[model samples]
Target: MFLRRIPSTIFGIITRSRLSRTIMSESPAKRLKTSPRKIGTHNGHFHADEALAVYILRLLPEYQDASLLRSRDPAALEECDIIVDVSGVYDGTKHFDHHQRTFAETFSAEYKTKLSSAGLIYKHFAPALISLRLNQPVSHPSVELLYQKVYKEFIEALDANDNGINAYPADVAPAFNTGGITLPSMVGALNPNWNTPVDQAGEDALFLQASKLMGETFARKLDYYISAWLPARDFVVDAINKRFEHDKDGRILVFASSIPWKDHLFTLEKELGITEEGNKPLYVLYSEGSKPGWRIQCVPVSKDSFESRKPLPDVWRGVRDDALSEVSGIPGGVFVHASGFIGGNKTFDGALEMAKKALVM
Candidate 1:
């Protein structure tokens, strides 16, 4: 089960704000936060609020111009019709208090470094604003109405963009564009599987074409979800099971980038009886250096070690083979390389899936 960490205090603050009251009021403008000038302007700018903001924007047309803010810019709000803040949604305690001041400072510094790379200034900014009405109650009817309007507009835009001349016959001009002509070749390319007819091929062909262009985006997403995120906890549990099955005769190796993840694995091992089994001992290897132990090996991957192996993949396979042979004494163990955000999970899952399929072979 995935547990979500939320700060109750933040929710309490939002619930108690004056903005909440205004949102609950009956006035349409108060509920909608629509300025007279903004009502006529079809163009709207949206600020990226976090991962959730992307989801929200996906559902709203008026908020379609949304892009992640590289840095905190309070002044940027002046040019936008609405602003969204997503910072409050994260688990503050886990990220901040758990690590103490040093952890918090380090996290902030790293965040600033990313911002600087993107040419953004590191300044304090708030998320979830719909214009000047900062921290207003979000539950008001006006807010809801605005949300609906934005959503509707976004949907319409998507439909128009999807169905315009490129999607239809060259003779058919887009509803939004006046004098532009769509080429038959562009339309044909858009409707590659035209033999199936529009009504029948609509959804399937659209997805097929999109997959070709995006390089199996959906398949990769599925692979990551099943492989990486779902398995982290299970990996620990499985290692414990394997340890017990082997009666400490075999070693368990765990990999992770954070202490919390490491601790979680440790706890899981203990819970699963891997700790108490007299047969094998567990050793943890990390940046603090190596400790002598028995059945378990904890190795920390350090920046220096990573830097020392500069030629990377050309020599990585040989180095990995040597390490595995030394540790497991098992030759020809599978070598899996997973990279990118979901790479770890995808690789893990793909391996398992392939193994399952290979049973038939």
Candidate 2:
């Protein structure tokens, strides 16, 4: 959940100055002959998708010095190298517009909804873009994992919104009435109010403002996946491979070090052929390095679910040390939560034993 925003100072005006100097100092023949690439999107109102699309383009080396043209004029769009969201034509390359009536493109066959400019650009460029940013090899498993992870976790929502996909059924009550701030909603808020007296220039300024917001959000999301999330996946995968070393049936997993494993656990289960209920691990044990010893936690049914696939024995609930040890007939017992979701022990072996006893119960 830790996302580091792509600082406005880095991708904003400061880099613009450096880019200008680099272009200006080049030989007169090279500099004067070639026109700077211009990135085009519509003027007036903006959305998170287009703003994010623009930001994605700027991350590449080629478009670093590219001019941003916020215009509806076809003549202006013709001069630009890449026209996004405004142009009404998608060629799967230079022109990426999703607003046309005939457009029916998606990121993959698994998705039914059409892609917006954000998804379009991300689908085409994100793998390389992420690899370049993180300094990881493009072929790295982490890069591809992060690419899909970012889309599923972040960019997919933008595509859905831009395509006018209703998240809730008409009859269903919303879980959150009004307080949630989605990216599209945030971008929409930056538009000039109906009552406000603003010219096209003012609208253009607001468009840039929206891009800054989207840019920071996109950067932070990417940063989190690259720096924090990908490593956690690797840790989880390794734990899955060595599950049997801890127990006979491989139904209890033990981690040498603590890491975020919840998100990757179920997905790894299916991939590792631990699909059936009997084949899967009932609980996870990890060294609680910062605390006394180890933690034994019930495995959740799924990522968004609070329900455990198999919770600890009900007798262990809310019990501590001596009482828990006496009740369970195991030593080095520490404590178990009231909900039976988690328990702790004074040793790794004790924690593993706790999880095993629960499995039999």
Candidate 3:
């Protein structure tokens, strides 16, 4: 049966009441304020630092929908909630610019180079930015770890470039330079070329393009740390903690699963007070990737160093299978790397035994 439609006057009253109630329920911050928040930067050439700085600010709740203003006019920027890179003022609160003569800000005391807009925002807002992006608490260990890692891996280079600080001394030539295609260089390239007509509108479009590029790079790198790198560190930590269970002397560590463990291994060893002479790791036993056996790897003296603390027996280098078994008197022998840094066996027990034997030799 078709019901009669409600009177138009009554429907309007009900609709208005519900709308008013909904508006009242929203918190002041969540409600559409009188004006959108504003972020101000320079009008001309774009750089990775300010582009990234804008991206980080937008990641936070307060500035998600903020308007960006690029202009050198003081009056235009004065209305912005935050001014970056062009304000010539750095109070460590809102305005962040490193170009001023008196500006002497750094992300940390460990770094000598002055900070750029990217480093400035990261230093103060990293915990919140990371927490918001990853949906993790600001105080989470991962957040704290990533806060430092992101700067070291991504933001530091931008800061150095913006500050005109050379990564190496002037005397030493760089091993390789990508013809200045670094992140900062790429962002700067987004700016209109010298031959192009200068227009505020053109520069603004370039700024947006640069911001998108910087934002994507930050996101991809952060995800790698959170998803792949962090999980591997857990395995490394567990292996380091239980090292003695595999070897009575605690000189050999075993990982049940394969992982990227070199960096974590060296770092954890020092943090766990295992850096002493006998306590230091000499070998690592772990499963091989895409294979059916285990590997015995000699721990390197340093992450970058080619020298291993204790290489496999000389007879095992470049040897395999029956020959290796015959030389070492160990069963299930597989190939040993020519460098003597790693060897493998058909079983976990066999690989562990290989490490133990190498330890003595």
Candidate 4:
């Protein structure tokens, strides 16, 4: 059972080497030239921004096997290949900290919320990252579109959350209490509970756990937007472009079949310069597909709003079938929602008639 004692410094190196991966780049030349990259962030009490930032950096080819050195120690940080959230600097190249007084970078002039380490790195790396995932060139249309879409839909929220920006004005209260369901909240819960004991290795392990959670969610969102959301844009755009064919006033849009379009209607309208009060679409008509009829849906005032810009006629609301047709002067009227947000018609002409009348009403 006898064993010889080794120097503590030599033992430290032995353990660290095993803890960090040496995968490096797959190319033999790069593998020989590059050691595993070091990603630096603060130690003790991690938050979502730094955790997600570290995870995102590891997604890049250069940092796939990157070792994380979670420390606030200046010398250790300076030795890191890339530092985030701890160095108090903000250069798109290396340091990506948001704590500096001079740090006021938003994604661009169009956005007002300040960037976090996650947003800053995402802004700089998104196109390249997307290109890698999509197997397309960096200049491809999808990459450019997904770059902005991902930032707006996913990263902006994280940036806002990390920078302490409120999603709504304090004067108004939320309708329901969500408790701690948000990504930031979930990541925060992974931390060693304040009253619980902690160790260096234990903290790093939890940090990686938070990072993997963030990375998986991020990847899934990016994938959904690419696979499901983006493809519908062109169809919606075509429907909008051909609106005049359905109605002379260009207020009613007709789609041959139903598609995921509510958000695209609003987005494409603005992009196509349909800003005037008279020019905006009031109703969208599309076949009900599996069902026997067509739907005439009111365009909401905004994406999440319940209020419509112009709802179906109040008289026709809560009416159905023959009664709806007679009341609205549109035959084959299947039904009109009590809320006046949508209506169904037995034929395309019936839906068109309903839309036209509602536009003027």
Candidate 5:
């Protein structure tokens, strides 16, 4: 998060500067009369955080066509409309520098990872940006959800990478060289290599290239969250709320249609008090429009775990159609996976019965 306090004197100064920029940006005529919105960051050896921070700022209406100012000169930076990932001061108004010794901000109290310039910019501007993308009020539930989720999934990683925060514990080592290619690595690759002649204009061009890449990737993730991910929550919540209709034990969830549901299932479980064994959903039944059957899937122990809370009966494993129906004494059976993670039936009732029989058998 950005520093909460802004000294009154400094606030007055920043407010006027920001106000002037806003006024200048309101019309093309005025912007031509004055200077365009100028985004400032230190030149040379750019990192993913600042690239992403600059990109995030450009998403705002005020800075959509903002000019980039790559410089280390304080006088030059002072002339810009806003500063990011540079300048020693972090009043959360004019300056958004995180390199200062006093800087120790996180996304929220719940988070302990120190924020980079990316996180700082996102913390301040993401809600309104999300609102713009979603066409809703800043206070809207979907907008808030998208804001938090996008930060966690996208922005936080850039912050963590820039701040040198390890994703895993020091004691833990990955089985493989996991970081094959990533945003930080990609951004770092864009920098001038050793012995490469550093042309100022060329460097600026490459920096904008990196910034655009970061911005487009971020926007794509946000777009997915808005169009696909957010809608799944409604489906999952509807299923969760209607679980009792699926079974008296409240251990089965039935969806009218298939959805991207695993994440929502886990989150909504904790949120809606699906913690107890008796009420916890163990199976999810959903229809496939392409196939004439309803698939019943065993819920994983957790979102990341491969283990199911209760897999389908072992006898039904790899069995198909009439054979499975005969073995399980449940008609209209489709094949159960060899792993016993999932099965299908010709009808929803048959699927429910299979789940019920699996529960007891």
Candidate 6:
């Protein structure tokens, strides 16, 4: 099993006035009034969602001078010169019984609606862009590259079963197969000597064992995927540098769909040395069970938590402010998540318009 710990100094500041000058010299906007752009990225397959966000940002300049300005509040729209919806899904309406409504029927739909209602422009880019940008065949290896390190370790444990009495041969080991077992049967399999009156007990035991083994195998596969896709992280880092031009005061927020995606970003941060004074990045707020290195504040949404919070705009403002302060002296600061907001009546076309307005704001 391969084991390597990511460094704690990934978020360090690289200060050089010369580098900053070079960056600024390359952009025509050096003399223009560049408003603060708020980018909201959602995690989905192929990084297409993020790619869409980037695409929207690219379109902002064009839209700033286009004809899509009549349907929106020119004032509120100006608050953010650019709002990129990196969330990979779109918003749609569904009719249930006698009433009609625009709500997310899938993951993408939910995200689109949330951003739109919040008055942010949302874009839902086709998933194909991700494949095109990657320009890599989706071989078995690529599919397997999405796993996490812990998942790989779990598979190893099942493969080796080296814990003596509890060991199972790699050949017959349930972990070798991706299929899972049922909970009760797995328990029975581990303790076969005991007799149970239920005829289904034996089958249940087998299923339980299989489930445990399957979980381990899945984790291993995930780790492999992440290791393979590390290059994508470089692409994102470069994009940030090019778009923001080493704006140390700006905050970047990244939203991904799964743990693996978050882990990928975490790994990239380590590689790029984005740290705090050569120390680990500080996680001021986080959900329970989120790992330290992941740099994610996993907040599971529920009715109660949702009701207790301030409006989405206020929440976003707070997050943006905090991130900016944290990386006060650094060239750029980033916040990443798998999913940020729920979807509403917003469409990709609307998001493009929003992006355009953001640039001029």
Estimated TM-score for each candidate: 0.24, 0.86, 0.84, 0.83, 0.86, 0.26
Show where candidate 4 strays beyond 4 Å. 1-27, 173-176, 289-292, 321-334, 346-349
For each candidate, what is the lDDT? Answer: 0.28, 0.81, 0.79, 0.81, 0.82, 0.28
lDDT of 5 at 149: 89
Off by over 4 Å in 5: 1-35, 320-323
> Model 5, range 1-361, lDDT digits (tens) per residue?
0111111232223234544565665677766754447888888898888888887776665665578788899999998878999988787776888989989999999888888998999999999877766668899998888888888888888888888899989999789985659988898899999789787777887787788777777777877888889999998888887888867878899888888799898888788776887679999999987878899999999887889999999999999999999999989998899999999999988999999999987
Candidate 4 versus truth, CA RMSD in Å, comes to: 7.9
User: On residues 1-361, what C-alpha lDDT tens digit does candidate 3 reach at each position?
Assistant: 1111112132123233443464567788766772357888888778899988887776555565578888888988887888899888998777988898988887778888789999998898778866754567898888988888788888888889988998878999788866976888888888898998766766777778888788767767776776677779988887777888877888888887677788788878777777677778899888886789999988889987899998898878999998998888889999899999999999998998898888888
Which scores higher on lDDT, 4 or 5? Answer: 5
TM-score of 5: 0.86
For every model shown, the clashing-pair count is 16, 0, 0, 0, 1, 55
On TM-score, the stronger of 1 and 2 is 2
> Any residue pairs clashing in model 5, and if so which?
1-106
Please tell me which predicted candidate would have the highest lDDT against the true structure: 5
Ten-residue stretch with the least lDDT total in model 2: 1-10
Worst lDDT run of 10 residues, candidate 1, spans: 116-125
Instruction: Give the per-residue lDDT digits (tens) of candidate 1, residues 1-361.
Output: 1111111122223333443453456477544554221100011111111222222222222232233221134344334343333111113211101112222221133221121100110011111332212224556543443333332322222223322313467897667954333222232345435364444224333422322322222123323332343345555554545543422353423333222234345445466565533232232211111422111122223312322111112221333333533332333323323210010111323222322222222
Tens digit per residue, CA lDDT, model 2, 310-351: 888898899999999998888998999999999989998888
Against the correct fold, how does model 1 do in TM-score? 0.24
Q: Give the Å shift of residue 104 in candidate 4.
A: 1.9
Better of 4 and 6 by TM-score: 4
**Winner of 1 and 3 under lDDT:** 3
